[model samples]
Target: MPQATVMERTPFIKPNPASTQAAAVSDGSRIGFENVSVTYGALTVLHSFTLTVNPGEIVALIGPSGSGKTTALRAVAGFVRPSSGRILIGDRDVTNLAPYDRKIGMVVQNYALFPHMRVDENVAFGLRAHGASEDLIRSRVPECLSMVGMSAYAKRYPRELSGGQQQRVAIARALAPRPQVLLLDEPLSALDAQIRRSMLDELAKLHRDLPNLTVLYVTHDQSEALTLANHIGIMRDGRLQAFGDSKALFRHPPNRFAAEFLGRANLLPVSGLKPADEGMAQVRFGGIALSARNHHGLADGSDCLICIRPHDFRFSRSAAEPNSVSGTVLSVQWQGDVHNITLNIGGEALRMSCPPMTNPPGLGETVSVHFNPAEVTLVPEDGARG
Candidate 1:
């Protein structure tokens, strides 16, 4: 038995019952993990985790490498068994079920296609293994290939196709079985940026066409999760930090890890010992006063931290508005469509990304930054406030 790695302890938030139930009932597929924990030898890869995926729903598992996103998918796919608890597919307990008996289709990053088999034959392999009639395999293989726009290249072997085409074949092979759940493990990571973009479009179309298929997509790409998944599960270490619709989690992350991981955020530490009316408090940062929403109901003489997104920070040469911070421009990088500016403030580097570089400020110049209080999140410095 080996020791559990440091990345296996990240926390995750389960979706509320209303959201989970609504998503499950609306979609045709249902997946649920109840108090699930998995250990390999002596290393516990997943904690007591629970999550639900509705039918026809695409849930993107986003996290750092070794955070157990793939482990969770494998648990659901029956590749890895939970040491305790149950996995339910469409309300049936499938935790102890065999991988082949689980009836799930998997497409991984490597696009593992049979080297000797032609594209059509690769797509038909699963159906044939499942003992589908020859007529059904013939009818379904072409249709699956056509769905991924690989019908014309059905006769091409895996080695003859480009990386993207081979991935399409892999997807075709996975979809040919039409399993209750589709598990995609970083399926676009093998392709170049351009091909990845094109495949995303094709995947989006596939989602629209087959609205009844439950998709459990695993990726480390944040932008891909944002673009493809209606619901997102943010994992850290091995725990799920947050799970909700893309919009809700992005708009309001429950913790500092989630706020920073889901996207770019500017964290500002603040402290004060006084409280205002109705459990609300005014904390000062960099000699400027700011009001906190105080969802944690802070008492008098309690310290709190503040978080503001980089985009939320607006810049102006003249300091005329409230909630302004003064900083010296460190360096600037032109990213074609936007300018990423690093500013030096209070011994910490603050980054600001502004739209399409036009008349940007010069480096070494001092600038005033403004941010809305509403856009700011109030978190306690010691993991107390959200």
Candidate 2:
């Protein structure tokens, strides 16, 4: 990996105890957007969105293009002023502050390195802009580069380095100012898959080294958000759909958009649902009665969708088993460690992931798939927020 190569060039710098204490004395690095909104004339880009990012936490905002994830990040950076509400960093209001005055660092998707400048000069740009002394800039430049494991390439120009190396320079430049918060706007989107994965590890390590640095990352990639974020905020059509810990949100999404966005979900339409024993629901799908854990306020005879992850289904030997559905295997795809089996059950296609070591039914073969009731989640059919 490029970061590993850079790490080999210099010893990792540990944060000094005294410096840590000084940095934490007034640690107001937490970020909050209270009922914020942004508009461009008649079109609203961000709705009345509100979320809080804890100090030193990495919060990834994820959604499709035009979903307002980037707009929220830009609001925090002070590039686009909010049309309503306020933005807070720690306890101070930064809603009206200029981008540079906000003391925030941003790394854009393109890396945005100056082509003509050497890496060291690029890393020194932020410090110089903030009017740091010459000696301080000199000392900080090498330290930032070293943190990113790019100190040895400080003399090289952007054109002379590979894509991964250039990204490291961009990150080093952002960190040089020692801003209270870091905003990453799809910083790894330009790289290839392997390089992107390597850089993700590097960013996680960088966060560990800088414990007080709060990060608000924006990306449309679900895997990136799941892997790097402590909390994830899902957005669509300018509205904040859901916000919670990455794992919890993925496991128990509040709405259909969130369930479908975060990962692959089998959203099966169910009817004739009634309250059963122990906070469970009995629902009928394709004339078969099945039990599922009920958390949503589903009334008797109400129709809803049942959400079950692909991995939650297992291959059953017979259709007589509880919560079993008989189907024909439409396709079987080998995905390295597991096989993804697509089954056509009563005209509906359901996907299930099976371990490669286990025997998955061949294509065009009849099969029975089973899932435990506890693994199922019920979502409202209308999907209207109550």
Candidate 3:
């Protein structure tokens, strides 16, 4: 776990539901968790969880299992009562509302479609539960199925379709009621890798089609989060470790845990920090005066870490990249399209990923990797101490 840093740069637009949901609709389409917490007996499962899912935006809560990401989703679904604080859909307080009262569409990992019912029937069930008219059910069911590209499978039973098809039906069922809020809990985890990738594309397309739909997506897969979410919240041990726009969070991680979890990061111990040109800062790393973005604003001469992605370390230098590190080639591996090289620099291991090279440094050979200062980011080394 890492010491937390508040990361949202812009205020999230709020949630809004259908006009029929007078009890749930307030202003816009958004979800707000106000210091919500959940505890069972002596153990706390969620700790003051708070975040906003803006209108038409997808926010993914990603972390290792048991980190309370699912618990946070359930709280919004009204399946878990918060021990304190409030939950709101739009401006309406939903903390005390029943699950049925919230105009929310939910898709879970298991696909939750009725095995005995046809795809069309499953999609109509939600509409019926809300007491919609027969005409509306007939039209909405087909529209939702079509939205998920499952219109052709309307008459097929859940067992008759493939895993991907079943998941599509589940999504259609969730979307049938025209809910403004969509909660997805690892919705693509049941499918194979190929199907999962396809579903990610489908989901992105679905969101584009329904621009006003706000989504709260929970997953343990970081890649899924990065591919689908506009903003990502990294959680650990029942707390949010970091949150920001996907690219900014990945490009400039705030702490050690976030840096390593969101993507590949090569962190090196550094101190003697001092301001450099423009927004960059300088630090000392094994006699190398490295320059990087001091994201945490760590003071001068303070111990911190600089994070460099493996792909950012270049095999050759240019005029723009003045920082270079020399090391002994410990391992060189050709991983299909790229080469993964492990270097030993002053007893510390530094990894570099480069495009397929015609000539790679052999084992025990001295080599140097150059990186631009703009590609380096400083992170607070307050967590991930292993």
Q: For candidate 1, write residues 201-286 as lDDT tens digits.
A: 99999999888888999998888999899899988767898899997777666677777788887777777735656545678776
Taking the tens digit of each residue's C-alpha lDDT, what string does model 3 give over 1-87?
222222232111122233222223224568999998888766777899889888889999998888899989888887777888889
lDDT at residue 318 of model 3 (Cα atoms): 38
Would you give me the overall lDDT of model 3? 0.83
User: What order do candidates take by lDDT, descending?
Assistant: 2, 3, 1
| Residue-level lDDT tens digits of model 2 in 1-386 | 01100012111122332231113312688999999888877777888889999888999999989999998998888767787888998998988766655667789899888899999999987776665677878788899899888989989999999888899999998888677888999999999999999999999999999887899999989999999999999998999988998988887777788888899988889999889888899999988898887776778898888888999999787777779989999999998999998999988899999789556677799988899898878877665422
Q: What is the C-alpha lDDT of each candidate?
A: 0.78, 0.83, 0.83
TM-score head-to-head 2 vs 3, winner: 3
**Deviation (Å) of 386 in candidate 2:** 19
Clashing pairs in 3: 14-29, 14-30, 15-28, 15-29, 15-30, 16-28, 16-29
Q: Judging by lDDT, tell me the better candidate of 1 and 2.
A: 2
Q: Which is superior by lDDT, 1 or 3?
A: 3
